[model samples]
Every structure is written in structure tokens, then in C-alpha cells.
Target: MFDTTTTPDSFARVFTKGRLSIGLITPLEAYPESPFPTLKDHQQAAKQAEDASFSSLWIRDVPFYDPNFGDAAQMLDPFVYAGYLAAVTERITLGTTGIVLPLREPVAVAKQALSVDQLTDGRFVLGLSTGDRPVEYPAFNIDFEDRAARYREAIEVIRTLSENHFPKAETMRFGTFSGTLDMHPKPIHGRLPIMAVGRSGQPIEWLAQNVDAWVWAVDESAAIREILSALQTSALDGRPPAYGYSTFFDLDPNPDAPYQRFYNVVRIGRKALIERLLHHRDLGVQHVALNLKPSRRSAQSVIAEMGTHVLPALEAA
Candidate 1:
């Protein structure tokens, strides 16, 4: 089981052992026709989410826009945006869907994460991934094939710096930490909750032992159950880490419409969405971060509707 004593408030707010929490992914406005969002009223939208009782808000790291990939992904640096949001929203948990770990220096990553954690008053969660964009690797002079190794190394560097005082450590790709120097501003809690977004090129067993949580893009209940079962069986100390997923959501305007899927997006009515989420809760999913970029309506409208309708229903359920 997770040591609640050492976990940040954001981790507990977002991931309970048996319940499901809902969060909105940033660029929290719809831009169905283009790759980029206008980011209009972005701050207001964030505050709206907090006011609506949404469990958290997530930002994505898209360092470069590959027109081929077609999504610009919020177009702001995630850490900077997260810091900005920290000031505007008081209670909502702030997080990254993930930072592409291999593309950035690990020590800098640790500093930024701790800075956001402090700004949020212990309301930040750090999600990291081995990036999927092959085009991005060569641009950074990094080998695409070596990301898995680098990803692991980055996590070690971040953790060692966060959890220890003047921690002496040697790493293959990220240089060494001398015992004479220490990273400043340790996590407000003893540690920041590190979530692995997607497999990040690691085996399930490795994730089970290393990360505080795991999230991917899986859509089926049975598939989720199977993966959760595998994670439970492989977990260290017989305790499964929290599990969650992200989805491109397109909520139907009608409250009674049935759940429908279109590739990675789910186009469903509020009622069925509630049922689906409840099902996920029963299956042991700890969080669900919804990306509303695919919505036909304005993202603000969707947020308002879900807050007024779906969130209350989930609470009652």
C-alpha cells in the first residue's frame, strides 16, 4: 500500500485506492478545426474547474509541434503553465499528463517539479514518460532507441535529488551528484508522487515497483481489469499502485444518449458517462483525465455541463 504519510495532498486528492476521480487536461478549450487552441479565457476555465469540484487539472508537454502529429498540445511549457495555474486555483490538484523525460535534463526536471509542488502548497503530481515522438529525439541529439534507459536514469536522478540531503549518486546519462551539494526546496510532503504515463517503454512489473501510479489510453473495462490484475500480482509488497487513463472526450449534449466510441475519443451523454466512470471505479481505476479537444461544443460548455450534471451524479453514485 502507498504510504499516505509521505504522499502529497494532490496524490491523495486524485487517487484513492478504490474510487475514481475526474480531471481535465489543459488547453481546456475545444479546437476541433485546428491543431492549436486559442487558449482564450484559459485562466478562467481553470478556475471554473476548481469551482466545479473537479479533482485535478493536467497539462501536457509538447516541446515541439510536428505538423504531422497535428496537435500543438496547449502550446505553453507545461511546468510554466502549471506554475501559473497554481496561483489561480486554490484547491485543485495540478499535474502534467506527463513530461517527456528523455528529452530534458533530469536535475532541471526535479527543480521544476519541486517548484510547482511548493507553489501549489503540496498540490502537484509529476507524471513522466519516455516520449513517443521519434522526430523529436534526433532534434535533441538523443538516440530514440536509448530513451528507455534514459527514462529510468532520469527517474533515479529526480528521486535521489528530491528525497535525500546532499545525495551522492552516479548516473550514466545525467552526470553525477556529489555529496557536498544538495538540491534545495525538498517536496512539501516527503516525496512527490511520480506517475508513469503510458508504459514509457517499461515492463508492467518494472512500473509496478517503480512508479506511484500508472496511466495509459486504454478504453475497455476488461482490458483495464486485466492490466490492473497483472499490476496487483506484480506489485512490490503486495500492494498495487494506483491506476488511471486518459481519453479524448466528446460529451453528447443529450443527457440520455448512450456511450459511443470513435477511435480514441468517447462521445457519450452525461448519464452513460457517469455509469462508465462508476464501472471504472469498481474496476479500481483511481483517476480519469479527460481531454476535451475533440468536443463539438466549446470546452467551457462541456466543463460547465459536466460540473453541473455529471460530477454531482458521480458523487451521489
Candidate 2:
């Protein structure tokens, strides 16, 4: 049984118990159906997010550009950008909206995660998943069908390395660690908070027992609540895993504009957005990363508005 009462590290604190916080996903600007974003001002924007009281900044892992996928998504390695962001920002949590676990080796994952953890002083959270893109699996020479097994094995290997030095681990897919070799710069919290992205082909019970939290796509509050309610009893050791989701949001320049739902986004004013976030908090969602790709306003403008209006409203709520 995993203990839920343990004090969370800084990264985990962004998604603290019984609280809801808002964050922005990178390439923070409004891309609007384009695969590219001008990243020259990323550092300045990140600093602004932290200063504005945004809880976290999320980076995504898209190793290669596929025409079918349509978006390159920051076009920088997530770990590299994470380290860069950690260096620039003072207190905002640096997280990977997700890194595809099966595409990379566990030892490398552990080392990179630990490096960022140490660099940020325990301000890193790893959102992990077994990737869904078939195009990438073949390019990496990994069998797509066996990704679930690899993902599970990789997690075990990472956990073993994080918790124990000179630990022996035998994995069916991730090879073996004979306790002879050990990795250094372990996570500042003994283990980094690993949030499982989507289903990753694992059962609810398994995820609840293993990962620190669950990351999902944003949906209607009622629907999201129904799903979470169903999983209430499946949590291992009677501690429900924290819930997070990615959402598309376009904050209108008009603060009083009415809410209008888009395909995957909700175009609304700050008042409506604050109400939505508060509703999600009531439904037990601890954190939500807002994707501004569909936004109508520039990232700078949106961030300013949110900082002045939306963020304060959430805090007050």
C-alpha cells in the first residue's frame, strides 16, 4: 500500500491535495493549427509565468516530426528544455506533460530525470507513457505491440534505481541491473513523482498502485467525475492517486466574453475560465495544464490577463 500522507516535494506541491492550480504548456504561444512556434522568447515567458504565480510549466516529448501528426511541439528535447527551464525559472515546477517511456532506455531515463531533479532541487515531475504513435515505434526499432511490457518494466527499473543504490534488478524487457553498477544524483525526494499519462494500457488498479498520479485528457466535469468516482475503490492502500488533465483554452481579450466550447478547447473570458477551473477542483482535479495552441490572443497578452485576473481568482477560490 502506497502511503499518501507522506509530504510531497516541490513538484508534487503544485498538484497538492485538495487544491487546484493552473499551468501552461509549452510552446506557450498561440500556434493555431501550425506545427511551429517562435521560441525566441521562451525564457522570458517562463520567467513571467513563475512571477505570475502559475503553478507549473509542462514540456512534451516529440522525438521526430511526422507529417501525419502535424505538430512538432516545441521541437526541443523535453529533458534538455526541462534543464534549461529549471535554470531560468525560480520556483515554478518543471514537468514533462509526458515522455514516451518505451522509446528510451530506463537507465538513461533515470539519469536524465535525476539530473533535472538535482538541478531544480526537487522541482521536477515526470509524466510518462507508452507512446501511441506507430510511426515512432518502427523508427526506434522497438516492437509497438510489446510497448506495454516495456513501459511496465522500465518503470520498475527506474523505481529500483531511484530507491536503492547498487540495487540488483532483473527485468524481462529492460535487461538486468546486477547491483555492480549504480547511478548517481538520485532524485532529491528519494523518488521523483511519476504521473502516468493516459491509460498506457495499464489497468486502473495497477496505475493507482504504482504511479504517483494519473494524467488524462480534459473532458466535461460530470464525465470526468464519473470516471474518477468509479476508480475510488481501486486505489491501492486506500489512497487515491492524484488526477490531472490537459486542456485547450483560449482566453478572449474581453474579460466578460461568454464561454463557447470548441472541438477540444473552450474559448472563454477569464470569468468563465475561473468558474470552470473551480468546478474541476470540486471534482477532485488537482492540476490542469492549459494548451494555448488554439488561443486567439498572443501568449504574452494571455499570460498578462491570466496573471492579473484568472490566477488570482483561482487562488482566492
Candidate 3:
């Protein structure tokens, strides 16, 4: 969710009301491990997403890697990498596909995120999730079982730190505060937009009550429908829109190849991928972030293909 003290002007253009956006998630490919993205590919991909006219490029925050978890999410500190990506690209918004909330203290996270937001001139949007992997929890001495509660709490703490005449509120789990502590380098817009990763068992009312937007993941068709239904119910004035989606791509790029999806990764041709996304749109997905995970000769190749073959059609879809 976003800060009440902050206004819409503080957000990226994509955060404006009833908007539509398409973005790419990085790593930008399918990998069984965490630390494997090509340094060259990562930099080029950020520019390519912008050059291709995409609205945003999202990077994942995987604080700790659990090999058993099977996916490393490109293994970089998202905020630091975001700083790098911010410097490299001009317009495309930089996002954290998500930062796992329960893995670290909220204050450290908020300070760094604010720094990135300022560096990017307010082009930061954060995706947050209550971590699900059991292995990731214990490493931080946090109970994996109750992360959902901690997740909610972390969101609250971050918001308070990001806004509120800081030195005023005594910090708890995040950090100790003495006086009105204002986070340096305020958001370009005064607030950063937050997209809740999944309901995380928190209710649609809560999602509507909190996050600036909500995300649809995995292959759940009904999930997007449910979110839209809640958006209508949660309307305060003129129906506030809630984003919905499930990321997919033409991995393998072979139409005849038997399609498969793992970790939300899908293998299909560009045409099939478009159809599935359109289906989601019809169901009320206002924004969709593509993860172009197909087994291409290169990540840039997939980005090029999406720009040339997929994006144009989706614009009309």
C-alpha cells in the first residue's frame, strides 16, 4: 500500500487512475539457480525494455537463496541493482518484482528503497510478498509460519518510516528512532506506489484497503476475477481499479513444442502467449508484467521478439 500523506503526483504515471501498463520481469529468463544472469544481458535488458516502449522493468529481491526453493531470482540485492538500472535507463519505471517482506527489517528496506526512488526521480514501484518458502524464514530467525502477520506489519512500519514526521513515532521492529526522522531524499512524488504480490491470505478488503494495487500471479484465472470483484466492492468514489495478471512467455519459441509452465514460466509461441494475456485482460487485468522466460539464444533475443512480435499485438488486445 501507499502513504496517505503522499499524493498521486508522487507516483509514476502508470499509477494514475484507470491506467494500463506492461512491464518485463528480470533475470528475464528461466534459470534453476539464483546467481546466473549475464552482466551484459542485465544492463541491455533494462534499456531494451525502455527502448521497446514498455512502461516498466521489474527486478526481484531474493535476500537469501534456498537452493531447494529451485529458483534464485537472478541473485542480486534488488534495491542496489535497481540503483544501477535506474542510472542506465531513462524513462522506464524500475520496480522490485517483489521484495520478500518478512526476510529483513523494514527500516533498512525503507531507507534503501527511498534512496532508489529518489535516484530514479520517483520512478520506483515496489512489489511485496510474505515469503512462502520455509527455508528462507529460519535463516532470518523469523517464523515462516506466521509471516503473513509479519508481512502486514512490515508494510505498516515501512509506510510510517517513509512518511510521518519521522522522529515523532517511536520505532519498534524496524529501528529505534529518537526524533522527527525524515527519510532523506524523499520520493520524487513524495510516495512510492506499492503493489501487493498476492492476497497472502489477507482478504480482498485488506488489499483494497491498503496497497495502491494488487497483482495476479501463477495460473489462477479466478484470482483476477476475484480481485476485480473486490475492486468494485472496495470502490470509494468512481471504482478504483485493481491490477491483475499471471506472467507468461513463449519460452522455447516453438509452437509445436509441448508447452509447460513451472514457477509461472510458460513455453509457447508469441501468438499463444498473446491470447492467454488477452484472456486475462478480458477478465480485468489492467497491467501485466511479462517475464519472457523462453529458452532463447539470449535474453536480449526474447526482449527483441517481444517488442517486434508480442507488444504491438497486446497493445491492441
Candidate 4:
């Protein structure tokens, strides 16, 4: 049911092939290493990000707060938050940095995904993953070792149920299905564009063949180059899936703050941040989501700067 024609879905329009767009990760506040957001004025921040014309507002899928895990993500259920944000904001796409697929049933996930898609008027993008947190797997009573295989199974189920009306299939995780039952509230374009984070336990080729896009963490441009090179070699048919990368940014108070790397994050100023994003674009990144929790300034100001300076520059390029 997916539209393979020139008319792209809302998600595909913003995350266009061969172009780069910037999006903000939510709980939009200066929490640094802490999991909690001030949350008091975040509704306003969400409005601001949309006004600033960010391509999307992203939320994380953190089911629980593992004290040892340190960061609790946005501290909200992603689907719930997406539904809320979809109502609160206009025009901006609602996305998940990822939803943990192996933890939930495929039909349930499909229903929720399509619900959000309709709620947002086709502005939803599904980013699914196998989930890396060991603490979360056991908490859900799922075997950590089987997650990869289950993840692959769930992908098939989601795709099948989304595209076919009363699909017939046999699978280990989703069980057998006949043409007797069909998924309801079909996606706006008949299917939602599926993106995956990391490997999700499948080979690069498998991911390349199935998913519309792929996301990963990058500390440097070299990693992006390697991924782009690999994508060129293993892409489905001749259509290479879009590649995206995410990083934490601590925007310095100075407008001309220099770039410095810390682990997977960068503590940099707007000028430097713009330079980095353009470089990422040059490296074939279709999209990048920035987490502002590490910033010293208010999330409002960071959002404004990115909206005014960063996103515009990238869009123009």
C-alpha cells in the first residue's frame, strides 16, 4: 500500500532522498545527564520548535527508568507523547528515534502506529529497533538472546499487516494468519515508512532490503563515510535507503563557539554546529536529530538558534 511514486509521505517529504533535515529530540530542556526535564514550560518549547520550522520533533521509547542506565530518555511513552504532540503542534512531523519492536506484539504495534498516523494526518514516521538495553528486556519478560530474531519477525509482520488487507502468513512471533482478518485504519498512504536504528540483529543487507531508512550513532564523519560506502554496495535493487545519524549537542553560549568532541556528543557553538551539519549532509546523511539536554542554555534558545541558523542553512544547501 506504500506509495512508491513521486508523491512522498509526510515522513519522506521532510527526510527527502539526497537532502538533509534537522529535528529536535523531545523533553526539550537542558537536563544534561539527568533524565528529568523541567517539563514545566516544555509545551511552549514544543510550540517553539514547530515555529522554528524543525522538520520533526522526536521522542524516545524508554519503558522504564533503570537507575544504572543513567538517562531515562524523554520519560514518556513515545506513542502517547506522539499522539499528544501531534495534536499540540501543526505541520511538524512526529517521529520516534525508535520504538522497541521485540517487546510488543506486532498487531498491537501496527494499530498504534496507524492510529498516530491518522491522528497526525499522515505526519508519523516509524523508527523501530531491537532495543539494546538489557535491563529493559527482562523487565518485559523477553529473552534478550532471542530479541534479534524476534525483531526480524516483527518487522515482517508489521510490513505485511500494513500493506496487505487480511494478509495470510505464518511466522514464529506473530503466529499464523489467514486472509480472514485485516488490520484496520490503514496508513494514510497505505503504509508507513519504516526506519530502523542500529542493526536490529539483521545483516546490513537484510536491513537495506527491508527498511526505508537506517539510523546510527556517530562520533565522527569517518563512521558516516563507511556507512554510506556500505549502503552503496548493498542497497535494495538500485535504490539505496536513506541514512540518518544522531548526536547530543551542548550549544555553547558564545555564537562562535568552537567544536569539541566528547564521546558521541559535541559541545559546540552555532557556527560550528552549522559547519558540522553541512559536513554531515556532504557525507550523505538524509537527516539528523539533535538532543539538547546537554546544553548549558535553555532549550528554548537552542531551539531558536537551530531554527534560525542551523535548519535554514541546511535546507538551503
Candidate 5:
């Protein structure tokens, strides 16, 4: 059901126009402290996202199911789930809310992501995270201390795997095949866009140097501005556009509270939501993914409500 009309770079256009294209962080809308969501939830939510006209969907990579950590993503693997979403939903971009490259084999990631890009007509945005989750790295037998270094190397490996038949990779994956092996079925436009999730393993400086776009964590406007300002000032790489994500409690149509929250406790109306959207645009956040989780509202109702209220504010802005 993925659309062939829009390419990965087209998603980038949403940034340049000072426009917003909302997406969801999977488990599709669950609590911050929830372990996992049902696969049925992911399936239904994918359809809802497409039906609601969300520009994209986001998923995260969690290698281990630490009880203390609380959130385990959606138990099924991220790319596998993305493929399922792609098959069922048309036009919405499917992406990793983030993949922790430090613990993963880059070549494997490259193969999986490329397959997804090709099969889904290239609607993939890379929310790549370096993975500071201490428990995950130990479980994977990866060094948490040097994740930043590994992250850079892994990115090189993934990029090479996608762009060339025989790529120069220096990491562990490169050891598997020293000679050339062509990575078949390149993405629709030959590649997917990679956006770094916060300043994961490396400094914000290195992230700006490498990734295509930036997504500041926690939907913090100030954090987004700080990083954006640093990127603008630093000479690391190209100027990058930035975005953020948050979760909503799904307030009623009419006003109750008159303000918003870091956890998205909004005490207001559609006008307040619109005003916030405009403020984010003014603050220079290009996209915001709302985690409709831990809410009193169910996924379907929240998606519908957000579409009616949130999507228009984004589109009109």
C-alpha cells in the first residue's frame, strides 16, 4: 500500500517550507512506562495513521526487554513492523523512530533498511540513535563507553551498503566480506534519509556533521533550539533542519485547562493547540510526532481527534 509518488527527499521539503508533517512513535500510542503493545495494535494503528493522513510513522529499536526500562518498543522488530505497515498503509512514510546502531550489525541494518526502502517505494526516514541505554549495550556485548565511535562507523557501513555495490567499510561487518557484494534493490531514489535522534552517542556537533536532519528528544522546544543553534554556528557539516516529538493525553474538543505540558497535559482548546503548533514553527521545529500513549483516550479516538485538530493546524501553518 506504500505510494510510489513521494520520495524520501520529498519529506525533506516539509522541513524547508516551515511546514509540519506529524507521525507516531510506535507501540502506536502507549505509556512511557509500558513494556510493549500488541501487534494487533501496531497493525490497526498503521491503518489509522494512513487513514488520518499522517505524513509518516515512527518506530524505535530496543535490543533488550529490561523490566526496569519500562518501554520495550513493539516486540516485533522495527523494520519487519515497518514492512507490515507499508503493505497495509498507502502514502504514509514509515521510519524508525530510532535504531540503536551501536549494538547492531550495520550490514544487517543496511540490508533490512534497503529492502524496506525498495519495497515501500522509499518512504523511510532514519531516526538513528546511538543508544545510551546502559542495559541494552551490556546485553548485546557492545561497549557502552565507545558507542559514539561505533555509531559513526556503523553509519559509514550503512551508507556504503546502500549506495555502492562494493563499499569500503572498516567495522565488524566489513570483515564478513572483503570483496565486493552488490546490495540489490536500492531505495526508490537510491537511498533513505537519516535523521539523528537527539545527540545520542556523539556530540551534537558530530550528529549535525553526519545525519540528514535532527529530531530533538522529548518534544522540548528549548532543546531543539539549542541544538539547531549549535549546528548553525558549528562548521561540522551542512545546515540541517530540526524537529521534535511528544505524547498527548487527548483532551476533549472544548477547553478545560488553558496550557500545555512537557508530558503533553494540555489544559486548553483547539486554538491553544494551533497556537502551540505556530509557536513550534516559529521556534523552527519542522516536524513533531505526538506519542498518543498513556492517555485516557484510546488510539482510534486520539488519532481522529488529532487529525481533526492537530493536522489542520500543521497543514494551514
Candidate 6:
């Protein structure tokens, strides 16, 4: 059970205990031929998503474009883009698919997250990761092998700064806070909903105890169930943190097309999409962030279709 009283509005809206909410990952466009998105009409797409009753919008932190890695995620600073989205949209929750924590300073990250939370009137969720690209570690002059410890340290620093006034804290990577000064712009809910995006070099037990939510990319139902069960068991005070996943989604133009899988992406009709989401909801998934980067159709068309047909049916369910 989640304590709604303490949950941030964005977290609460995007994740309910028994229901699954849908969100889209940005730059909400299809570019199957290339690794980088044009970022054209992105703002409009975000507005359209909100207008269509989408629950949230997610951004990724990919500071560099690794030709070998082959995906320049969103191609913008997540915090800056989030701020821009916060100003443009009225109600949709803004989130980071994840910000790679070990590659940046924790206190600055805390301030940026808090600022976004305040700007959105509590419609922000902070998702943190250890980062998958080892190349990024050296670029930031950070030790890749030490990310696990740094990841933990960053969480501690962020929490201490956000949840307490004039907090005193000592950390290994980040320096000590001696209670001489306080971090400004506290979370709108008194605590920001911190999510562990991917494992972040930590175990499920650590995530269950520390984060407010967990988002990964697992597809197997049994694996999801086992992981969710473990998370619930290890969670503090028996309150299971929210669980969800991201997938490359391609919604077929036809309403009745069968569900088909292609590696990480799923190409399905609106009807099948609804059924699949319902199945996930039953499996205890609280949210799903769909990536449209691999779609064959235009992003706007898919958004319109989902808004007109899929969302209402899911709401009725």
C-alpha cells in the first residue's frame, strides 16, 4: 500500500495501486532511419498528449551522442526541457525517464528537481539512474566502477536536502552539509517522489527501501511478478513502491490489428494495445511510458488515435 498523503501529486496521478496510467517519452517522434530526433513540433506533441488525457511526459538525460551507443536521447538537458514543458503545459506531469546521478553533482540535481517540482505545482517526478554508457563516466571524469556507491550517496544527499531544513550531512563523494545553509525551494509535497530508473547499480531490496517508485524494461509477466513481490516484501513499512516499465511502442493505424513484438518495441492495434495495458494493470503495473521513436506512423497521428479510441476505453475499464 502507498501512502497517498506523502506521495507527490505527479506520482499519485501517474501511479495508482490497481490502475495503470500511460505516459509518453520525448522527443515524441519516429526516426527509425537515424539515431537523433529532429525535435520538430515536440512542444505541440506534449500539449496534445496532455489535451488527450495522457498522465505524464518523460524526458531522458543523454548528455553526449555516442555513435557506438547509437541513440541521442531527446537531445536536450532534461532539467531545462522539463522547465520549458512545465511552463507550456498546465496539468501533465513532467518527469525524467532518468537523470544519470553519478555523472552530475547531487546538490545541483536536488535544486533543479525541487525547482521543477515547484514550477509544476507538484507535477514532477525525479527518476535517477547510474547510466548504461561507460563512455559518459569518463567524459564527466567520474569513475565508472564507483557509480554504485556514488549513486547511493547522491540519493542520500538529495533526500537530506529536500526533506529537511538546514540539514547536516556528510557524504563520501559529495562534501558535508554543516547546517549552516539550507537548500532552497523545498518539494511541493514536502518530499519529491524519487524513482529508481533501472537498477542504478543497486539491488531490488535497496530500491524498495529507498525510492518512491521503480521503472524498468522487463517484459516477462513472471519476472515482473517476482520482482514486484520482492519489492513489496522489502519495502519500508510494507508499502510497496510503484512499479512500471518503458517500451518502444508502435500503434497500428488499424483498430483491430494483432499484437506483434519486435525486440523491444510492440506494434499493435488500438484494441490490442488496450488489452495489453489492461493485462499489465492486472499484473500490478502502475504506469507505462511508451517510446514512439520507432513508430512507422507520424507521432501526431498516433497520439490522436490513442486519445480518440484507446484512452477512453482504458478509463472505462
Q: What is the lDDT of residue 65 in candidate 5?
A: 81
lDDT of 6 by residue, 79-129 (tens): 999999998899999999899999999999999999999999999999999
lDDT of 5 by residue, 187-249 (tens): 677666777775775775666567766675555577767766876675343454455554544
Tens digits of per-residue lDDT, candidate 2, 212-280, equal 778788568787887677567787656777888887888888878888987778889888778878988
- Give a tens-digit lDDT track for model 4, residues 105-215: 888888889999889988888889887688888888999999989988998898888889888999976778888998878888667878887788888777767787788
Query: How are the candidates ranked when ordered by TM-score, highest leading?
Result: 1, 6, 2, 4, 5, 3
Clashing pairs in 3: 1-211, 10-189, 34-72, 166-181, 167-179, 167-180, 167-181, 251-294, 252-295
Model 5 CA deviation exceeding 4 Å by range: 1-10, 30-34, 172-179, 218-221, 235-238, 246-256, 262-269
On a 0 to 1 TM-score scale, where does candidate 1 land against the true structure? Answer: 0.98
Model 3 error, position 250 (Å): 2.9
Off by over 4 Å in 2: 1-5
Better of 2 and 6 by TM-score: 6
lDDT of 3 by residue, 1-317 (tens): 44335545434344433344577778765443334555546777678878987777878777766667555666778888889888999888887768888787788888888888888878888778875566777777987777777778888877877766655554445556667467766666766677887666577667777787776674567765665777768755534545755475544566445546665666776667677767766776667776654454466777777788777877665
Give candidate 4's root-mean-square deviation (CA, Å): 1.7
Clash pairs detected, candidate 6: none
Which pairs clash in model 2?
A: none
User: lDDT (CA) for every model shown?
Assistant: 0.90, 0.83, 0.69, 0.81, 0.68, 0.90
Q: What count of clashes does model 5 give?
A: 4
lDDT of 3 at 251: 49
Q: RMSD to the native, candidate 1?
A: 1.0
Off by over 4 Å in 4: 1-9
RMSD (Cα, Å) for all candidates, in order, is 1.0, 1.6, 3.4, 1.7, 3.9, 1.2
Better of 2 and 4 by lDDT: 2
